[model samples]
Target: MGKRLAIAGVTGAVGQEFLQILDQRDFAFDSIKMLASKRSAGKKVTFKGKEYTIEELTEDSFGDVDIALFSCGGSRTKEFGPAAVKAGAVVVDNSSAYRMDPEVPLVVPEINAEAMKQHKGIIANPNCSTIIAIVPVWPLHKANPVKRMVVSTYQAASGAGMAAMRELEQQARQVLNGEEVTCDALKYQLAFNCYNHDSQTAPNGYNAEEMKMVNETRKIFDCPDIGISATCVRIPTLRAHCESINLEFESPITPDEVRELLSTAPGVTVMDDPENNRHPMPTDASGKDDVFVGRIRQDESVPDNCGINIWVAGDQIRKGAALNAVQIAEKLL
Candidate 1:
């Protein structure tokens, strides 16, 4: 029999993606519970041609749930995750609450499905940029061990949630109409411009988003010693995240060999067509399941052909958060 599933934060962006991906993948579930905050409660959502009412989330919400997919914020996850677990539900959490916990497995199913076996009750999904970067990187790492990675991300407004997406649209229209743009969802205007990620800056100068890439990449790859430097920026796109990744391998590996390796990698699609300059872009990756990889070339700065540069794009809400959590839930089944 299919498991009983509950979707927390059902009104949020990632929560909506969970419904779409589950239906797209035909995930077997006997029943589903739609949960949201008190303000979102009593709302209606349609799934698989049926409508369901959004119930207010409480500690008791998971009593009948076999698996709970949580996309609520870290605070909510911390407040409710253990309740779900104690009530006999496995939580595939998309927040950072339990990610760095030594007990919880930080999983990118494409990279480490086996790690799911180590979950005490919650399986932590890695950050969006980390997921998009490493899905394509893992295959290459298996071929030639990656010693270091320098990543620059062009993240979409969708990464900040639905309000930020609307803010981008509103700001763009306001700018074109010669009106004063108001900022609420994000810290600044995001139309026709870019800025460093809005996440708080740490004492070391890395923003929270950038640091997530550094720390989560190591945890997911199980290579704590691997060097990672990331500069994350918020672009004006609606969805999808793009990254420029410079990889230094332990030994020499050519761009052609990297392409060949990624071509067959699961959850990856090679889009390296330089002659016509058709490469991975946010527009191409939006709403897509596979992470698109392209621009495979040698990083001339590193010696002995040890460095390779590549570009990648993927739907952050899909693969990076909701879909990844669901994939871990699938492995449980």
Candidate 2:
């Protein structure tokens, strides 16, 4: 029999992708419950040719649910997660609420499906940038133990949410028409501009988004000692995120060897062809399930062929958040 499922925050961007991914993957579910905040309670959403009314997420929402995919922000997860667990439903939360919890497993199914086996009723999904970065990094790590990694990210407005995406479009049009740009979803104009990600600056001079890459990467890799540093920026792309990774391995590693490792890695695709200026880009990765990888070359600054640089891109909403949460649910089945 198919499992009974509940999707929290059904009115948000990731929630919408959750619906699309479920339909695309044909996830077996006997029934689904659409849930949202009180303001969006009566909204209508279509899934698998059937209409589902968005119901207010309350303490009583998970009575018959076997699994719940949560895309609501951290606050909601903190408020309602325990209730869902008490009601006997496993939760795959796509928020920062329970991610660092010692007992909760932070999972990216492609990299660590076994972590989900230890879930105590709730499992946390890693941050979007971490997910896109780690998918390709894990294979290389397995091949040659990585000593350190430095990453710079070009994140899309979609990572902020739907409001930011709509603002990007409006700002671009306003700029083309030579009008003053008004900022709502962000503090500055995103059209014809780029800025550091706005995910709350921390005391250590790193923003929350950048720190997520550092902390979550370690937790997911189960290598707390691995050295990692990240600089995250928000670009004007509508969807998909890109990253440039510099890896230093314990032993000498070559570009050709790294390519061979990633070629067969799950959820990764190579697009390296510098001769023709062909490589992974946000335009190509949008709406795709695989993380596109390219620009595999040696980092000349480091000696002994120990450093390799790579460029990669992936759909943040699909692989980063919603699809990852859904994949964890699939493992439960």
Candidate 3:
């Protein structure tokens, strides 16, 4: 028999993607439960030719579940994750709530599957950009330690949620139709425009999204002294996220070496063809599983060929969020 599984917040964007990915990968589950908010209860959802009624997620929801996948929100996770663990369910949370907690392991199956072996019932999926950034970086770090990293992200509206994605689509049509564009999911209009991530700004002048990258990287690598900085921006794209990264290694490294290393790296695909103007883009990455990497070149600022620049893109909803959470659940199996 397969493990009994439950997906909290099944009505949300990431929750829906979790179901899709589970089916796509044919993850075995003897029973699956769909859970949502009170408003979404009683809704019927079909999976694998059977319909399951969505239920309100209460403390009792995880009683018989062997594994629970959470993507509802941090507040819900804080309130109910312990309940799930108490009920003997291993939780794979996709929120930031427990990621920084020393007790919880922030895992990317491809990068740190072994971390899950130490979990005390809860495991965290890293932030989407952090996941996308680390998949390609970890391999190179293993080869040549990365001393410092600077990243700038072009995140899509979907990172905020499905509502944000719908808002962007509506705003774009309104802009072209000469009607007023309304904003709800995001602070500013996200149609045909871009802005810094709307997450609260810290006293350090970095937004919450930017700091997640800095802090999570150190924790995942177990290297507190590694220097890292990030600038996260919300671009007017529907899905997928792209990042420009500059890495300063402990020693000199070449673009060719980086390409060769990433080529064989699991969950990474190289699309560097500068002469033909080919490179990884959100359009090509949307709905894809692998993080697409390209635009490899030497950063001339650092001497001794110690710096290299690369661009990476991945489906914010897949490898970044839902798919990663499911992969963690797979490890438990």
Candidate 4:
């Protein structure tokens, strides 16, 4: 018999991606369990031509389960994640609930698969932006440490949830029809616009998502003293999210060397050629799993060839959330 796996929040966007990735990756599993909140219980989800019924999450949910992939949210993970771990199940949690815990390994497999080996039971998937950023940056850091970075993110509505995607479509039609634009999934209309902050309200003036990038990157990169600042904005797109990154290395670097590092980095596609007006964009990356990097150049304003500017894009729902969670499961297996 193969491993038995349980998925919490099995009906949500990330859950659906988990199913897709598992099927695509051909992971071996003897049985699959679907779990959700009581409000979503009794629903049927189809995967690999088999229908699985979702049950409400409970303390005994991990019985006989070897792995649990959690995306229900932070609160649920906080309340139930430990219980699952205590029940002899390894948890690959995709929430803010445990990523920062020193005891929990905040992992991005490409960047730090070794961290997974250190897992006592729970391994946290870093924030989507953090995961994507580190995928390209970690490889560079291996050659030399990064001392400072300033990033501005153009995130997608899907990061907020499925409702945000729907809102973007509906609101776009309303705008086309000249109807009054109403905000629901996000505080402001998400279509054809951008914001400097992540959520509508940011406690202490730091958007929650921005704070995640600044903080999570530090932990995943294992650099506590690195100077990092970020601004995460919700763009109108429905799937892929992008970021404009400016990084300063601890030592001098050349564009050629930077290109060499990223060109061959696993799970990263370096598509830079500014003369050809080529760069990674959300539309080109909406469905891709690899983090696309382009627009590579030395930031002339910042000292040395050490300063670099690049664009990054990835399927926020896939690598950002579900795909990453599933990858951890595959590693555990």
Clashes of each: 0, 0, 0, 0
Backbone clashes in model 3: 0
The number of clashing residue pairs in model 1 is 0
Q: Please provide, for model 2 over 1-333, each residue's C-alpha lDDT reduced to its tens digit, 9 standing for 90 to 100.
A: 889999999989999999999999999999999999999999899999999899999989999999999999999999999999999999999999999898999999888899888889999999999999999999999889888999999999999889999999999999999999999987789999999988789999999998899899899999999999899999999889999999999999999999999999999999999999999999999999999999999998888999999999999999988988988999999
Candidate 3 wrongly placed segments (more than 4 Å) = none
Clashes of 2: 0
The C-alpha lDDT values of all candidates are 0.93, 0.94, 0.95, 0.86
lDDT over C-alpha atoms for residue 138 of model 2: 97
Whole-model alpha-carbon lDDT for candidate 3: 0.95
Residue 204 of model 1 has an lDDT of 98
Q: Pick the candidate with the highest lDDT.
A: 3
Q: List residue ranges in candidate 4 displaced over 4 A.
A: 198-204
lDDT of 4 by residue, 242-326 (tens): 8888989988887788899998998899988788898888888876789999888888888766898878998899989998888
Candidate 3 per-residue lDDT, tens place, 1-333, comes to: 689999999999999999999999999999999999999999999988889999999999999999999999999999999999999999999999999999999999988899999999999999999999999999999999999999999999999999999999999999999999999998899898999999989998999999999999998988888899999999999889999999999999999999999999999999999999999999999999999999999999999999999999999999999999999899899
Alpha-carbon TM-score of each model against the true structure: 0.99, 0.99, 0.99, 0.96
Q: Rank the candidates by lDDT, best first.
A: 3, 2, 1, 4
RMSD of each: 0.7, 0.7, 0.6, 1.5
Per-residue alpha-carbon lDDT of candidate 1 for residues 155-260, written as tens digits (9 for 90 to 100): 9999999899999999999999999999999889899889999898999999999899988888888889999999999999998999999999999999889988
